[model samples]
Target: MTIFGEIAQITLRALLGRRRTLLMLLLAAIPILVGLLVRANARPGPVDVGAFLDAIVIRVVLPLVALVFGTAALGSELEDGTAVHVLTKPIRRSTIVLAKITVAGTLTAALLVPSTIVAGMLIAGLLNTRPGSDPITATFAIGLGVLVGSYLYAAIFVALSIVTSRGLLVGLGYALIWEGILAGLLPGSQVFSVREYVRGIAETLEPSSIESIVGSSAVAYAAIALVTASVIASLRLAVYEVRGGE
Candidate 1:
């Protein structure tokens, strides 16, 4: 019925943009490839989850995907001035924000779960190849962590895309500086880090299989704060103006 509504509809469609579509595929493939590599080298049994999660998910994949999808959901459109075309309508800005968030969040979650599972299976196979560790639980634990963590991170970044033009650059700083450095090196910062919560949830879900980086309650609160703030902030930042959001 309106410009935002029509464009929102386009973005919501699975095949709205080819560039974003290809990026999503590449993102999904990373985890799967890692899983295959691990499995090929060993057997799918018990996995060395700490090393795997730290190196694969935390160190590399998650942040990169967050940067790409989060920015692409809104930043790219803003940069290209395409956002102006849509905002020229009668639709509520809140609806447009929600639509963008939905697109980015869905892409992250849908791709992350399967990739984590595949990787976990491979790592587990390797650890159990010698017949000592419990590999079966590894897959479930990692998959569980991937699911919620992806959702949390995606939502946070999707909202972030609104506040900054350099979405990927800022997201990189968020991942490397906040999540990677400060959270890892300082216990004090852990209280405020989103990853702290993800690590906690992952541990809670994996209970016997993995040890979380922080306490459960702390992580729970941090996760909720990140998600809620992202949504609320994005809503407030909405500029109903048709041009430059001015």
Candidate 2:
């Protein structure tokens, strides 16, 4: 196996072999459960389903999941002093950081994508809800949006792990306070919010129906540029920290 593959395997094991994994699984299931409840309560239309997904899955669950997995990907290793052993290897620090963030991002996507799809599909069925667009297409688009957001969040939180041992606390604060509250209240701050990026991507995909609820003003190219920049900057910071420890 390649060095990146080896590091990713170790990261996967480290992340999955914990009680927190179970908690994350439960967390991922929350949207599906809520979808079931919504279906039971009332026959919600496409717009309502889109709004529910935007409010619950995109805004709340995605960040929380990414925060947990992303920080734990490297944070636990550093805290337990196991990362020093990996650092001692004849491997590039960039490779280590890349592998760690990739694993973290992929895991976050894997858990949330299906959850988002199922919840959206359950709330808005495979049938066409309107003339041009369908809930199924919008649902899959949102799932892809979650996939994009997961990697961005993972990269940011992985770098946070390197910068501080309190990565979880710091990430949680950023998600809940900065992105959740400040971004909502201060419209200009939406430029710095990953939630807004996700909304932008999703709105771009299913523009006709989801635009009203997702309410993102960011253009697709700008959102892509911001996400790409964040990921590169995050990986650079993580690599620098790892190399500085040498």
Candidate 3:
């Protein structure tokens, strides 16, 4: 089989693994549940639809979910020595890493895009009931921002899974400490945080709402930097034996 074919086989085999299936199903449900809850309640408030969606689902929910699934994407394989099966294949080591990253990133994007949309519809429905608001357009924009941001970070998270055995713990720290707390307080730190970038793209959906929190040029550059660096690191690290399976 060719590289793409091999990749497809690897991806499908990996997805068919027991744990990944459960993870996929659970991840798919997160946004749906959130959407249902939001649509069921929460009276309309005087906030930009993009900003509100970003604060709740984009910034908080998606990142946390990405950390969980992204890390598990390759991290579990490494921990269990399952990655050895792929590494020993006829394909180049780089292909193994790329294939795994593809699976993880694609799965993450699938979950986040649809889930965010579901949640956005819920939010939009509530906002639509109010006077003088275009919740659908704003919610649509928010979903776009979240999709871009999630794809970029999903790649980074997949790479990180290769480097660290404790991917989950470190990923959580990256999400909470680096993106959540420190990025706001420190200068130049905006270059590292994915949350800020998501917020920036999200601000495009509503400028004034998140202008105070996330910068435009800075967030854009940050997303590029994070994705590039992570890709490079993962490609390089793929040379090493992941778990040295027997």
Of the two candidates 2 and 3, the one with more favorable TM-score, higher being better, is 2
Candidate 3, residues 123-200: lDDT per residue as tens digits? 666654444556676566566666766666666777777777887888888888888788878997776777667767
The candidate scoring highest on lDDT is 2
The residue pairs in collision within model 1 are 43-125, 43-126, 44-125, 45-124, 45-125, 45-135, 46-124, 46-128, 46-135
lDDT of 2 by residue, 167-241 (tens): 999999999999878887885777778887777778778774355323555445445644564566455544544
Candidate lDDT scores, in order, read 0.65, 0.79, 0.66
Better of 2 and 3 by lDDT: 2
State the RMSD for candidate 2: 3.6
Which 10-residue window of candidate 2 scores lowest in summed lDDT?
212-221
